[model samples]
Each structure stands twice: as C-alpha cells, then as structure tokens.
Target: MVSAGLYWLLSLAFLWGGFVQMGYPGMAGEVCIAFVICLFLLRFILVKRFVAASVFNVAATVVFFIFIAILQAKGMTGVA
Candidate 1:
C-alpha cells in the first residue's frame, strides 16, 4: 500500500507541476513518464486486478490538466 501511495502522490505532483508550468515542454514529458510509472507501479503494488486505480489516476490527471489550462487561458486573456 505504501508503494501505491507513493505512486499516486508522485503522479499527482508531476501533473500539478506540468499544468502549472505548461510553457516547459520538458516538464510535460516528465509528467508523461510519471504517469506511465504510476500505471506500472500501481499494477505491481496493488495487484493486477487494480487496473481501475491506474485508469482513474490517468483520468484525473488529464482532467486537472485541462482545468488548469482553461484557467490559465482566461487569466492570460484578462491580463492582455
């Protein structure tokens, strides 16, 4: 369970950093790598049947990223 938690925490952190720093393509790549790591690590730690966990993690990360992007766009427009 500890490994699973670590996987999730790291994945979320990467996503948060990626969304906040979208101007950095390198960080985006790192976030993708982190997502893949979470998928494999969670599978190994939570048992093979826990595919839902990985799927949920990916879905949540993507959703958050989209939300951040929309907010950033609005902020930029207002600033301009």
Candidate 2:
C-alpha cells in the first residue's frame, strides 16, 4: 500500500513536469504510464492480486524507459 501510494505520487509528479515542460502532446506517454499505475492500484486494492499488480508495475517501468528513450531521441531530455 505504501509503495503504491509512493508510485502514484511519482507518476503525478512526472505527469506535471512533462506537461509543464512540453505541454499536452509531450504528455502522451506519461498519461499511459499513469493509467497503468491506476490499474495496478485498483487491482491491488479491490482484487488483492499481488502478482497482477506486480506485472502491471513492471509493465509501467518498461513503458517509462521506452518513453525516456523516445524523448532522448527527440532531444527533449526535460533539461530545460
């Protein structure tokens, strides 16, 4: 529960940062990541499916890396 809360907070922070730096178009990946996190939270809370939640968490991490790769390729990097 605590970890899930922390992940949720981190997702929100990333989404906000993405929106602020690059606007709505750049937030597409963040939105998908956030959706996966929400699903993970729902599965964990309502269904008590730890394994499924873990899978979702892994998927979200993979997606996040892919998003970062895409951003890097585009030279965004969120450095500004």
The CA lDDT of each predicted structure is 0.54, 0.58
- lDDT tens per residue, model 2, 1-80: 54555556656766666556554445555554565566556656754445565555555566556766876787656553
Compared with the true structure, what per-residue lDDT tens digits does model 1 show for residues 44-63? 67655655665655655565
**CA RMSD for every model?**
10.3, 5.0
What does the lDDT read for residue 20 in candidate 1? 62
Q: Candidate 1 lDDT (Cα, whole model)?
A: 0.54
